[model samples]
Target: MQARQLTLDVTLPDGSDFDAFHAGANGLALDSLRALARGEGERQLYLYGEPGSGKTHLLQAACHEASLWGRRAAYLPAFLLRQGGAHALEGLDQLDLVCLDGISALVGCVETETGLFNLINASRCRDTRLVLADTHAPRALSAALPDLGSRLVWGPVFQLQPLDDAGKRAVLVERARRRGFDLPGEVGEFLLRTCARDLATLMVQLERLEQASLRDQRRVTLPFARAVLGEGG
Candidate 1:
């Protein structure tokens, strides 16, 4: 796999990309997703993990990289599917890469299943790559369609694990850098202790800090973090 540069932002919303994601102990998942983006590995990839394990981020990263590499790519999250109708899957199967997040959300929805099953079949015909991310493993998911359950494991599966504290710090710092600022280790530690400790919450903290810093023309120092975040800090 190519070396990852953690501060480089992709064109995707919220700067989602391989470069901005902290793989931590989930390096295998990182490598596999990068391979998927490059169309160099298994045609289908299944990723399952706990809520803050960065599943959606990786899926978005895959789509971002795929699009950058000139491959047609789409990321289907639950709300989008609910809004667009799973029939939208029909229009996406022709893309070079498709990532379906929150596959667990389709548990009792037969129409969604029908659309996705057909999407799977059509994608296979066109050699379109597929990546699926959910909180449960394929067999563990209480899917309404047995064939869909069977098909999910036809390729490699990776269980993405949550990052440790060190990993979280690195990720937050990198995220800050991508937003055009530096995050000191002490400032990051303060945020970790003063705000929500989860990576997702920490990320939200970083976003808020970035906006505050830009508006105030202040650097991301310990005092700035304290002043901007106030009670939260």
Candidate 2:
């Protein structure tokens, strides 16, 4: 049998390339998802974290990993799939992994609420692993479905705490390395000190710096970061 070639246009926030993804602190989270892919113990995994805490990144990484393993993985943001009604659950049984982002968006709405419940049940019946990402913990979900709430607690739940300043700096430096931009330690520190602490914001700034560096045909330096940031070299 010929091997299947995987293809996807996975969109990263702010048009960042795949190399720019930072998975340093998310190693354990990835391992948990890998266990799910192997059909180990749990059928459901909940990833919870504050905004900008890399939950979505971890979810995307799981999807990417599953594809590399030649497994069928479907990634759907709950908010986007909810627009299609229950039919969205169709063919979900054929997948090995189902990754849902923004799962908390289904709270309160009767149709979406029921749709998510059905998805979970359908995936469970077929032994499919469900990876769900939400802004808050499952116990904090405001959905009206008691069974869904209870089922969420049945599996391994991981809460991703926000990265500390040092962690964030390491992430930035590592990302810069992958992007082929040699960011000096001092420059990385300068950006972290002056720019927003949020990863999303830092990613945006990094992209801007990438462009500015390319335009000037110079390596990323403290002066370049300061100049692009309008901080005046």
Candidate 3:
């Protein structure tokens, strides 16, 4: 399926790449994904982690990197295609890389499950790399399609670890720099303490702060960031 035919915004978001990802202890997983982006990989990879562990981030990042090298890459989130059914999986194997996010959401959809299995088989046939992510381990996910559920672990499954204090701060600083704002270590720490610690929420807050800083011609100091983010800081 060509991306242009869908209303869904599957394009890689800004600030999603290896440079923006805080790999933390998941450096090996990051390296593996980079290899897949270049069409030099183990053919299939499954990574599962808790919510907000950057699984989706890494998937989109992989797609972005693959596209940079002139390979056709697609980012498909199961939730967004719930109503579209198996049609979303069509023609995806023609791409060099396919990153499927939120695979757990497809457990109940028989058609989608079969479509995903076909996608996996097609990837193997075409030597295209497939990266799939979910919130549960391969065994934890219950699906009507036994073959699909049991085969999720056919490839390596990496459990992504959460970022530590320093890593979180680095992520914040890097994101701020991308938005043309300076985020001092102390201020980054402050935001971490006072706001939602999830990188996804932090990214939303960062966008708000960027707009606020530009409007007021102010630096992203502790007080300014706090004001922009309000009590969340």
Candidate 4:
């Protein structure tokens, strides 16, 4: 199938890369994913983690890295793929790397399950690396199709560890630096205490703060963050 025919025309989001992710205790998993992107090691990898544990980030980061090496790669979340039906996955093996996120969402959908199974087989034939992620272990989601579960774990599996509070702080500070700002230590602490701790939410709030800072011509100090975030007492 021609690339244009496929429903998956996802563009990797900016700042979603290895450098943007704070590996924390998942250093080994990060290394493995980097190697997979470069086509240096295993052809299939399964990653499981809780929300905000960096599963989606790493998957997209892998796709970005693979493209940097001139390999065609796509990061397809199963939720979005489901919207286009199982056929949306057709011909994905033509790419060098495919990162399938939220695989657990495909369990009850027979068409998607079979399509994913077939995609795995076709990927093996084409030597296309596949990276799949879910919030649960392979066994936990295998009740509907044991064979598919077994196939899911046919290669290396890694459970991404959730970052600790300190790690989250570091991520906020580092990510702010990447966006050309300084996230003061107290501001980070205040965000942690007052706002949603999930990296996704924190990042959104950070962008809001950045925009407000630029608009007001002020630094990202604790007072400015409080005012921008509306967390003032």
Candidate 5:
């Protein structure tokens, strides 16, 4: 099969705000990334979080920071890379940092599983930092390869807890501000009250809200939010 191309335009969230959803993160996730940034030992890190728990955000931020430090970092979603067959691992050795997201997708297949194992080994041998993100915990992955499971456990693992109601609201407000939309407090609260609480869903809702507000030439009010969300204002 031909290599399936998955291209996503990666950019930092806008606004002058630096408030991160992971601001309080001093656990394995933050520490491991910091270690890699500081050129310390333990170059491999594993991050586990539920969907929309900000795992991808932290990984992307790390990549952005690495770029500022003039280091080479490659972020690839594991699902896409695995679809390209084993040859995908060839050029990754050239990177200073490699981030793999959605790694659970590679669990069952022998070829992809072994390929990831080899990639991890190659990265270690080359002194490249490897970061892996998965929806489930590392020990819970049902991979058939015993060695692969062992390799995953070799890294420092962090579990990203789901954001509380306040945390989710803060994220929604910050994201809206970053996107150049003035989200009123009432509107933000309304969204959290009625829409999906996950970051991914909130992001999509914000994009829709932005379009609706622009088309109607009105600021984002609670009524507008509710009406646009089909919640019957």
Candidate 6:
């Protein structure tokens, strides 16, 4: 399909783009999502990993890239999608790319399974690319519908790896730079040692530090961060 944008109601979380992601050892997963965003590789992809492994970030990042490429895309979590019943999936194939996160939430729901099964079939007749992510691998997801389980594995499956200590430090520094400040190595180390290490939590802590530093007109020094973030730092 030709690259073209369409105005849609879906909203991605702020800073949820490819550049904000720290690849660490997930280069293959990241590259696959990039290709999918460009409409150039496998039309279906499955990503699974533990909490804080960046599955949701990568899914949103793919949508961000797809939009920048002028392709129509949507991101929907299966929990919310299930709440809307099977009809929620209607006409998803009309979009260039569709990202479904938290798919394991639909495991026991017959209606959602039926909807997704049909959507998968419809996607085959259109140019729609589907990216599904969850904490459990497809084989591990005891899908009530056998056919639906098989369909989930119809494309490449990648297990996203969590970032190491060095990677997390890199993420904090890079994100700080993007926000127009410097995150000193000592400050980063202090945050890592004190705050939640998960990227999501770390990003939130970074936001807090950024706002505090801007308000106080102070740099992000270790002492300043400790003061801003309190004893947690």
Scored by lDDT, model 4 comes in at 0.85
Each candidate's lDDT (Cα)? 0.80, 0.72, 0.81, 0.85, 0.73, 0.86
Which 10 successive residues of model 2 have the least lDDT summed?
Answer: 1-10
Candidate no. 6 TM-score? 0.93
* Candidate 4 minimal-lDDT segment of 10 residues: 1-10
Clashing residue pairs in candidate 1 are none
Q: Give one digit per residue, the lDDT tens place, for model 4 in 30-92.
A: 999999999889899999988989999999999889978988887887667667656767888
**Higher-lDDT candidate among 3 and 4?**
4
The estimated TM-scores of all candidates read 0.89, 0.86, 0.92, 0.94, 0.85, 0.93
Report the error of model 1 at residue 8, Å.
23
- Report the number of the highest-TM-score candidate: 4
Q: Which rank order by TM-score, best down to worst?
A: 4, 6, 3, 1, 2, 5
lDDT winner between 3 and 5, please give it.
3
Candidate 6 lDDT, 33-75, residue by residue in tens: 8999999989999999998999998999999999889998888
Candidate 3 TM-score, true structure as reference: 0.92
RMSD of each: 5.8, 4.2, 1.9, 1.8, 3.6, 3.0
lDDT of 3 by residue, 1-233 (tens): 35444323665678788788888999999999998888886778999898889899899889888878988787888676575667777887877888888887667778878987888888888887889898888888777886886567767899999888788888888888887778877677777888788877777777787888889988878788777777756
Give the alpha carbon lDDT tens digit for every residue of 1-233 in model 1: 11011112223476788888888888988998899888888788999998889998899999888878988777877665666566556566667888888776666688878777777788778888999888898889777876988788878999988888899899888887777889999998898889877777888888888999889888888888888887575
**Candidate 3 lDDT score at position 32:** 92
How badly does each model clash, as a count of residue pairs? Answer: 0, 0, 1, 0, 0, 0
- Model 6 Cα displacement at 38 (Å)? 0.8
Scored against the true structure, residue 149 in model 2 reaches a CA lDDT of: 88
Q: For model 5, how does the per-residue alpha-carbon lDDT over 1-233 read when each residue is reduced to its tens digit?
A: 11112212334454311235444443556666766754576788888888987777777766766766788776776555666655655567567777778888777888878888998888889888888898888889988876898899777888888777777777778777766788888877777777877878887888899999889998888877878887722
List of clashing residue pairs for candidate 3: 1-90
